[model samples]
Target: MNAPTATLHLLPEVNQREVPAALIEALKARFGDQCSTAQAVREQHGRDESSFEVPPPAAVVFAESTTDVADAVRLASQYDTPVIPFGAGSSLEGHLLAVQGGISLDVSRMNQVLSINADDLTVTVQPGITRKQLNEEIKATGLFFPIDPGADASIGGMTATRASGTNAVRYGTMRENVLALEVVTASGDVIRTGTRAKKSSAGYDLTRLMVGSEGTLGVITEITVRLYPLPEAVSAAICSFPSIEAAVRTTIQTIQLGVPIARVELIDHNTVRMVNAYAKLGLREEPLLLMEFHGSPTSVKEQAETVQEIASEFGGNAFEWASTPEERTRLWTARHNAYFAAVQSRPGCKAISTDTCVPISRLADCLLDSVAETDASGIPYFLVGHVGDGNFHFGYLINPEDPKERETAEALNQKLVMRALKLEGTCTGEHGVGLHKMGFLVDETGAGAVDMMRTIKRALDPKNILNPGKIFAL
Candidate 1:
């Protein structure tokens, strides 16, 4: 297969638009202490977990309410200034970068559970609430939201990126969980899409249109999402495999058999070593599958038995169960911290993370080839995945000052993405196309579909003032 060219490694062009002085003055007068032009604050809002960096936004507006958001957006719109939304700053794809020199509209202070319709299994919340915070607040209700994207990412950020996680193999992603939204259009007009109702045949599915728009179409102010009742029985287990291929094959078969596994994650031996060093969990050094099942006690047991048989067929070790809540939390926490563990394994290094998802039938084929290529390149990398859903990540640790390392990592990612696309998968399964994946978006969706996206963007955001220079160019 031909390697992706070096152009894919280039950052998006920087074209800083003028943030007029009058606009800043207007925002200050309107928002009072809520608006800030502090250099430090602007810098914090300017970047995310991604490797790319650009000049910080000219100012930062800490919006505390929908009116605050609307007014700030309205003033920026008047100056044709870009307004990039800021959430928990956990995005790995440069989604929060102010590449075109805009003002960062921070909604973190707006976090609140607006309403909870427990009987309806729906809850409406401000976009700023993080997933962990939401779950903690709703625990007493015996219902919880299942889309946990590792990081305690803001609901708005998760919704904007259409994020998924280990639970997605059963619960689905933000695209399916979000039931409604209250959005501020590019014109600073507040509008509502979808409803508390589970199904709708109403006009357009604007909720979906905005769910993964990455803040390009509008600013999500409020989100209503579906929730699930707490499982009567929950069991977590870990099974080691002789090779990544064997673990992946076990996952493929488990999925094919339609086992209702709640969460199934794959961690290579490299990652296991890193996690063991960092968290001191003393996990066995081998490729393993960390899985969980949720259902009635009988059904959960049946699912686990079936999976164990499938895994054993592929030479997987007997299941090691995390029978208690604390044990399960520890194992899952270690899995979630795999990226940080890998980063710390080599100090003074940053990770170029790749999110490539393939079809279940082709998971072993696509993953094995990428693994071989990465190993041959001799790059220090960590591999992990929500393999039950055929989605995975490879975090390549590289020194920031070393251009050569960056190029090598990008090349590896490009090959993986191409392989995934060829296998009828997506370049990104959860992380949306930020500046980093713009080229891949075109490659995967083709120019015509992207042009149609551009058309919709132009029509909805004529000034290109809302999170400009992201998702796609004008």
Candidate 2:
């Protein structure tokens, strides 16, 4: 594939709005001990995993229930103050930052599994519940939540970003899994969208609109999500490839052949070395595909055999299988730790993570070119991917003190995003457009579409008091 030239553009800055003293006093009085203006807490609630520099919020409100969230929003709305919703703060983009100062409404304390309709394969949960906690709560019922974004991110945060991870290739993303939602609008009024029924042709798809809105539109208080039955028989395997091209080719073919692969992850040679050193796993350091299949005993065996054959066609070797549950957990746990491993590879350095995704047919072109570009940039980096869905991330580690290194990483990121857009893909497949990708959003959606989005934003949030300065500029 021919790589396109990327021209970087400076994102427009939004002026910081001051929080009135009266509002802060009212919040302190209402929430009592729950309201916090302490510097440490504000700093903790201000930023996420991203490198964007922004001041923390003026205060934080630890909400314990939907009513708490509503009351907080109502107070913020009354003051026309921006309310930034905080979850686990695992967002790679700067979604949680209170760039325009207001109050950070934290929902981490509202974690509760409200109800489970096992018969309908659906569960209603508070916004603060983590994905792992929910699965553990319902695992005995033979149901599981499969969207794992590496971090044990809260379901609300995952839904806000419309996250998808390794299992997304098979189970789909939050966009498909979330059945309904109870959201607090900018006006601080609670509204429920969608229902338990499978399909609906009723009005607008408000649930989907809110899922990836990144808190600009509203705050999600509760979610009703579809769950999957635990597979009876499962098997995990890792196959090493002679080259990145071969591994990507194998992934494309597997997807094309319509194989029911539960998860297929690509780890570059550099990433493999880092994982081996960090996670203490003894595996060949080459371009590798860690995969899993789910089905009955006979079907699982058949799927594994078929995948092995496909991998073999592309110079894949050492097909290590992890059949037992403990073994599988170890393998996946190591895989999930790729980010931390990459970070530790270069101590005292930070990573500028890239989330470019292209069409499956263009996976080889997109990934190979990306790898070559990163290699030539002279910045230390590691590559990992959910190749089954044509989405991947590159953790470009750089010393924060070095301007030249940070510049190189940012330039490379721009080129990668442009290449994905050229290949008919997106700047972000799972990670939503926080402050990091505001300019890219305009590029991907065009000016008119962005205008429509702005119109909607103004319609819903007349005062622009929601999570301001995110997704797009007013």
CA RMSD (A), model 1? 1.4
Cα lDDT, all candidates? 0.92, 0.91
In terms of lDDT, the poorest run of 10 residues in model 2 is 3-12
Model 2 residue 169 CA deviation in Å: 0.6
Tens digits of per-residue lDDT, candidate 1, 1-474, equal 233324565577799998899999998999889989999999999878888879999999999999999998899999999999999999999888888997999999999999999999999999999999999999999999999889999999999999999899999999999999999999999999998987999998999999999999999999999999999999999999999999999999999989999999999999999999998888889999999999999999999999999999999995788768998998797799998999999999988999999989999999999999999998999999999999999999999899889989988999899999999999899988988887787778877888999999999999999888887778
lDDT of 2 by residue, 1-474 (tens): 223323553332657899999999999999999999999999999878887778899999999988899999999999999999999999988898887889999999989999999999999999999999999999988999999888999999999999999999999999999999999999889999999899999999999999999998899999999998999999999999999999999999999999999999999999999999999998899999999999898999999999999999999999989989998998886689899998999998888888988889999899999899999888999999999999999989999888788888888988888888889999899989887787687668787888999999999999998889988888
**Model 2 RMSD, rounded to 1 decimal:** 1.9
Estimated TM-score for each candidate: 0.98, 0.97
Q: Report the alpha-carbon TM-score of model 2 versus the true structure.
A: 0.97
How far in Å is the alpha carbon of 92 misplaced in model 1? 0.6
Most accurate candidate by TM-score: 1
Q: What is residue 308's positional error in candidate 2, in angstroms?
A: 0.3
